[model samples]
Target: MFDISMAEWSQNAPARARLLLVGGLVALTGVLALVFSLREPGSIAIAEWWPAASAAVAAALCARKHERPYVAVGVVLLVFLGLLSGGRSLELSFLDSVGNAVEAWLVAAIIAARRQQLSLKTVADVGRLLVATVAGAAVAALCVATGAHLVGLDFAASFVPIAAAHALTIVCIVPLVIIPRLHFRVSTPPKTIAISGALVLSVLAAFYPGSPAPLTFLPVPILAWAALSQSMFTAVFQLIGVLGGISALTIFGGGPFAYVTGAVPGIAFLQLYSFTLAALALLIGAAAQERRVIERERLALASLVRGAFERGPNGFAVLQEAASNWFELIEINAAAPALVPDSFEHSAGQWRLQRASRLHEIISRLSAGTEQTFEWSAAPGAASTAQLTITVGHQPNGSRTVVLAITDLAPMREAQRKLEEQLARERAISNELRKLNQQKDDFVASVSHELRTPITSILGYAEDMRENHGVTADEESLEVIERNAMRLLAVVDDVLLISRRNSDTSEPPARRRIAVGRAIDQCVSDLGRFAASKSVEVHVKVAPDTYLYVPESDFARVLSNLVTNAIKFSVPGATVKITADTKGDEVMLEVEDSGRGISREDRDRIFDPFYRSPQAIRDGIPGTGLGLPISRDLVHSMGGSIGLKSVLGEGTCVEVRIPLVRPEATQ
Candidate 1:
């Protein structure tokens, strides 16, 4: 629609070219009108038909070029020249010419403003042109009547003839010139041309000089034929030819209308007939064009739908829902024919009998407007089942077509079975590894428990021998043996603790409301001898009455381990700071030491069982590496967390957070 409106002559041509075209058309129209006017024997008082006719054609062409102003100026100049060539005096000629120019300007202005191109693709386009022609002719008729009255003539006598002649001329000639140029594809089929030629010849014969008046109706059916079979441009030219033939016969006083006495009355009847025939032809032609366009679009959509359905991979079938919940097959693609034999069968019983119960469940869901999918095995009991995946979709419509798509699922099912088997094997291996780990922990626990008794006995005998015997030179060796025995006992105790914790499924320790500050003080006092032996200062900064809801023994063990590590790692003159504070329902305890800090690489494994940093090993630290892992387990068992942060060459700080017991809750 947008393309049609913008198809003006100036769209492709430059301004100068459009101007030249308009000028040439205007000059040619003027020359034709002048020649036609010379053949009229009427006085200047009568309306000159040629000037009105010529102006209408020229105005339509200029409007097509989108030059309305040029149309107005050129039309007035041409009308004036047409009148002057007919030998009219200057003053009278100018007044009459102005009226014709105004009529032409009205036609051009209306068409340009509506942006209506001079093509008849629809009935509305033809109707709009007809209305504009009538309106412009009426205004020009009034102008001609007013001029005639001033020249001492009757207004009614001149107005009617001038209006009728101008209206008929525009209806016939303007379309003849404009439609041909605007609608470029004007070819008709050979059969259509032959039919139109025959119709024109028949209309001419009907209006022959000696023909009866009843024969004049013969052209009506012929005109209808031309309208339906030929292009709109051809249909229009046929109507024009029919009108011209009637006019030529009537002018020679030979046609049926010529039998009437007066020329005006006879010509009026002929013009009325031509007007009615032209309108009918235009309507029929527009309708035919619209029908052709609709048919083309319908065929295009059908082709696209058919191609999509045929190209699909899965078996596709459409079933129409019928009475009693039965579905009748409506359409099926190529792949579907092999899946279900006897394509024209209406019942679902045949296909349903061969498929499994699962396929029936999916179809039942789809019938209720719920999309569903399920798998069907063609050979259910075979070792390698031939499976198909069927998807059912409900299409919304009066008939309620259900579209079913089927795909083979044998390959996919086989792949899924292999994956499941692999997963089962991995689970079996993981369970075996877990049983072996439990056995290792049990062995470690048994060994540590047995060694503890022997180590204690050795320590006692070493001490007793040194005290009971008289002073000897080997006293230093005996003291060294006793010191090593106590260290071995401590190591044995740590191993037993870790083993028991891992293997035992014991209940958690009872939560007791105890002052966390008192626990810190106890841990500091117990480790005081160790700190003194190393010459390291121990500082305690715990808030008074800071209480936690945790087992007192676990809290004490956690604190003792952290403080002992801090003291062991510090330099001789450095301080080990132990602080505890309450924050938002939790007790935060921190043990900081001014010692060589752990490296970034060793921090990740510091809490693992029997794991120690390389720096600690290099320094020949005197302790087992189970302290941190035991402390972490004890803290976690009492609903608390422990974390360590350190910087190389700076210091190490360990933090523990345990839930604090509120005073009100303890009461």
Candidate 2:
């Protein structure tokens, strides 16, 4: 348990302690052995007073694992020298020494195995030690009994004394050695001294030589006094001292134990008395120690709670109920008095008058053991307001007291008012912006419609001039007029579409389950002539069974715009690929082309209405810039998304995903 080794034994501080302990145990064992061996025949031997054995057991219990072998060796050698000095045969001495060492080791092992249970400050630990002591000593006694029988001595007599002595020794000394050491001072030194003196005197008077009186009860009350008033260590020490003295006196033909007819019976009576006294003292001392610990903890917790209450930010006042349903202020924290108005006690101001009436209602709720809260101010235009919370606390004697807490509400109210004003201003600005946006959309829609009619009329008139007027020389001019008119018409149509989509009153186009493969075929067929004119190839790859839930005309317009843009941007002989496939629950459509792609700076805002790329304007590439925006809006209305991936000078791929019509929905 101590994590010690033979190397650490000499180098560590505990090693020195162990050496001193072993020396003391050896010296005590030597003296006791000498006294017992030199005893005269037919005299009391006091075999139940083996203090050295208990001390050896305590040392073994406390020793580190690696240090135990050295301790055991010391014990065996000490016992052997003492037995050999007392004139015992070499073989008998060796056997007896081995038995004692084994007993100490066995008892130590048993107690250490249950170390957590053995605080040695409780009656339960004392009882456990008694059991272990009896078990170990019984085994040692069997060894001694066998040795005596082999040597032609009385085996039964040797066995009883051996067992009784070891058991009694352990019961007396082990607790004193193993209990937690304390540096406690007696509260009343004079009273402690008097009780200690009384105990010593009683032990002497009770065990007087040849007294024929049963005065043994005299020391019982004195022992109890020491156990209850003194520390456990002091009480246990006194117990051992009294028991040792009584045993010594009885062995020398004195005390009530000496009056017994037989030596064995007298030794047994002394053993019983010692064990009873030891158990009583240990139980009382342990109970006292446990109670002291609980009381100290309680006082510490109370102090902490009081400290927090006094230092907290909120104002607090404790009120106790008085006669006739009235209440009186009993206690207050540091902040409480400042929060209370001077007029509240005088009952003069309107605030104080209102509080007086409110206190009556608060007291009623508090008496009913319910918590209540309310706000109050000094007057109608008071600069500050406070909220009071009242809670009931029950006392140990069943009387109820109420605690009132006050909190300032001025900062919270001001924050709420400012937040409301900010929200109102935001709402007004938002409404004005909405109205301006609506007017812009209306103007674009009306102007686009007017321009579309004139543009169509110009294209028709240019066709008639080239065909009917036979203008052979102005043919190129007529063709230019028709081309410009067509481009203007396309721009006007795109603006009209965007405005219609932006209008709140515009209804969504009706949807149908259109075959996506057929739609792609129709879009490519319409773009075939334009692709040929630009010398760009158009590739269509579509799944025949793929269907989409969208308006057919809108889908055609979105596909046409995408294809036309790809053809316009691509170099001559470059391929424009249109592909559509079903993926999961959606239909994926892609239009890819090897073209001069848009730059990253232009791509971000390319979807904005009328936002033509600078490159397109510089290169004379035609685009209304509303193509992607209108495409995105139309796709969104039909529950789809559109995005593009482009690398400048490499190519661009515009991908669109639209929800596929399910068979269950079609049914």
Candidate 3:
């Protein structure tokens, strides 16, 4: 048979090197002792001691292995040696020796039970465990008596005191072992307090003298509580208490002879056999708990990783680089599963084997944690307006997680196409409006040229008649003709300006960086005479050093139009406030009127071309109805914007924001 006992994996056994080292040291020590004791120089006396040395080595191996069967065999070997020393005269009784045999069985049983617990999962299999504790203690007691009998000692008298001492020991140390095993799911404070209390009680009990003669049944109540608790940890702990507490009590007793050298107090001899049983049992229980925890932790970790893998936003695959050389789609999310539902072993429809794919190289580097993100535009015929991004996970090897976030091109693309179509239509309409304005300008120029000669002639004749002919006149008729002609001439001049100046190119728009405070001041100064005619004043409120980059003429036109409207709409003596300030790089200018404000519904439409407010219509205000729109156009052309805000009764404020210099622009 193969020598399984000599295998490297043998439990707790020393290695060959250890054994050899120990043997050499022991040999040297024996020589030293012989030389010292006798005061003579001599070689080690090995010739007479070969068998004993061999036996000792074997015993050491048996004990170090901590296997129950090996231990039993070792014990039998020792007993055999004892019998050999005494010869046939060393007689023994079968019934008296029964206790020793039973104790051996109990010790073996407890050791095997603990090993099984460490290897097995379910607590339903602790049958040997239940048998080992009580049975082992009783059997140990019996062995001490049997050994006492064999030695021609007073077995009965010694057994009672020793067993009582064992019981006291059991009561003391058992609780210490058991408290650690109760893995109760409670708050930490309560558990700490409870474990400490148990330890204190056990220690006290151990030191106390006097208890039942046999401690065989002392651990029963705790074991019962353990079984009722249905906690494997609890059960193991209680077993520990039963085993360790009792063993400590016994081992600490007056024992060096234990079972063999029965020369010391009987208490010492009693503990030797009993304490061994406790050690074996506790070791087994602890090993079992460790195994259970390791298994549970492994399973819990697997569950957690699997959950993240399956529920994450993107699809994941594990690609093997073998003869199969294919990606196995491992997990897919609810949103993206339909697109990358499963992997293909070989290329099917659109898929192709790429000899060198940048995508693949990128993924390889990402999986190695060399890169976090890889961005690339969509492939040809793919959505043109969107891009793809791939972010890598931490794990190495396998195909890197490929996150394909594709934006749909339908809405934005369609909107852009529609915008182009609308722009074309607007361009055509703009061309038509420009032609109409050109025709109106031509007609006004023609009418003014034709009417200017006759008006000059009539004015000249009237002046000539007043100066040269000295005729009697009706004062009222004369005043009426002069006043009416002057009024018609003024109206004609306004019509000419409105029709022609809109398209007239003057000095190529004159681009410059104009301070908004200066701009507003200029507008007020230019329109001061007009405001004076209506008995209205224009108030300029502007912070200093506010600058903007714009075509000076366009900005000036915007200011001129807004201030003109403010003065026109305001009541006489109502001041128009024109304010200017800078927000970052943009110059914000405002013209507020204290006249009747525009209505909420009309505010937006008032900026439309040819649009007039209801209040202006009701008041019969004479306007071209192109002021706000023209102002908006001029402002936007100069990289600026205009807007109007008002309450129904409160006055109106026309706001214009023009861009600053390129170096100063915030955007």
Q: What is the C-alpha lDDT of each candidate?
A: 0.70, 0.75, 0.51
| Model 1 C-alpha lDDT per residue in residues 505-583, reported as the tens digit of each score | 6455677888877777777887676788799998889888788787777777788789989998998999999888988
Query: Pairs clashing in candidate 3?
Result: 118-288, 169-249, 170-246, 173-245, 174-241, 174-245, 178-241, 254-268, 255-268, 258-269
After superposing candidate 3 on the true structure, give the runs of residues whose Cα lies further than 4 Å from its correct spot: 1-326, 331-362, 365-367, 370-386, 396-400, 408-415, 474-476, 506-667
RMSD of each: 11.1, 9.4, 23.7
lDDT of 3 at 212: 31
Residue-level lDDT tens digits of model 2 in 122-240: 55656667777888778777876676767777888778877777777777787765676543453367876777788878887888787667788888888887888877777878888
Identify the leading candidate in terms of TM-score. 2
Candidate 1 to native Cα RMSD, angstroms: 11.1
Error of 1 at 469 (Å): 33
Q: Least accurate stretch of 10 residues (summed lDDT) in model 2? A: 1-10
**lDDT of predicted model 1:** 0.70
lDDT per residue (tens digit) for residues 243-307 in model 3: 45544554455112223344455444334434443344434444554555566678889999878
Global Cα lDDT for candidate 3: 0.51
TM-score of each: 0.56, 0.64, 0.29
For all candidates, the clash counts are: 0, 0, 10
